[model samples]
Target: MLRRFGSKFLQNSLLLTLSGLYSTAALHAQQPAVNPAPIPLNPSQKAAAIAGNVQGKALIQQATALLKSGQLDSAIPILQRASVLRYVDPTSHFYLGLVYDQKGMSQMALENYTLAIKRANALGMDSAQLRINLGNTLCKLNFLKEAEFDYKRAIEIDDKNDVAHLNLGRVLLFKGDNQGAFRELSRASALMATDPNLPLYQALALKGMGNNEECKNQLQIFLDRAAGTHSDPRVISMAQNLLAELK
Candidate 1:
């Protein structure tokens, strides 16, 4: 169920730091709980399915298949085609951005996200998600100041966006501002326990403040809880290595 709910930003900085988190795959897994009964699609809409586009119901499902199968290389061409179609929706471009990000094609990803952003703004669409994605990408690219501005803009648009807070906190932590990072991470943790990054980041923030014992305990708790969560190998490995060295 990789929906790419808000990963337009990761595409831009995927080469620098490939972290997508629950914003796409993990966030989509939560959808069933939110919408227990999906409305049936109309037959006329079924006829609108791309006829010559490889026989798929729509470009989106085809792209999803490519992504799920890890055939990212094969997906890009199809995604590009979809984006150029007259009837193509913003979601098409959004997922294209996600694919490029996952494939480590930052420039292409950024371009797609920018396109999506423009279209969303034009239609007064769900622009907040695009802002979050762009902010996350900028943060990874080491453009922390600009990324922070995007996150603040997102907050202004949607005060309850927990992912934006988490991302902003991560940037603050990387900037060596432990106190500010802690506040944002704490708020994100309060909003979603599924976010392993919160506790793991909290430990790092504590470590930065020279609270060695507290950091160790928090890291141990995070490691234990994160074991079955499919946490990224890189993130888990880095955190574990850091904790061991700290002790």
Candidate 2:
């Protein structure tokens, strides 16, 4: 049964929540709530806002297409123009952060992600995915505490966010909070039962808590599930080494 489940998981692994990138559905999920008492705008002001919004949408669409085609450099200017628009969508800054992150520019990614959050707030929008992306950049910059905070906030926004829970588990592990890491990992595992990586993380947390037997069991489960899949070779190697050490 486990093998069958593992094979099914491997086949659908592309849909895993680990990646911090937002899909079109996720973008829509982050849409701002309707304001019951929106501030009235004058006719000219509303007309100008509509024009800016239309232009910004076009730029964002163009940038998204470039990003999809792996033309990260070309996407940058278009997204930058969108970011400066009068009614800019926060998604522009979010995409800019993703491009910078993919380019290995952690500081630039962090800056854009910060701007994204600020813009999102201004637009009366809150997004778990945005927080997750920002947390990922923070992790890359070695800002573990900041990343933890972001992950926690993401969870608060959407408690069912398995990515946030998984990331929070990782951060807790790094901070040597073994029990806390285990608790978060358990929650993530419950939320995403098919994720093979969860067992590895759970094993690490168990090992940290000196539960050698349980850790070994989790390592074996990880190895079994990861076999014949596209799991990271480095991670598999580490799991093998850890399992051997436990033995």
**Which 10-residue span in candidate 1 carries the lowest summed lDDT?**
27-36
Which residue pairs of candidate 2 clash?
none
Runs in model 2 with CA error above 4 Å?
Answer: 1-45, 86-88, 193-195
Tens-digit per-residue lDDT, 7-111, candidate 2: 334322312323322211222234333222244789998787778777988998898878778898999999898887734457788888888878878899899
Task: Estimate, for each residue in 166-232, the C-alpha lDDT of model 1 and write its tens digit.
Answer: 8778777767788888888888787773576677778767866767788778878888988888777
Task: For residue 18, give model 2's deviation from the true position in Å.
Answer: 14
lDDT agreement with native, every candidate:
0.63, 0.75
lDDT, candidate 1, at 230: 79
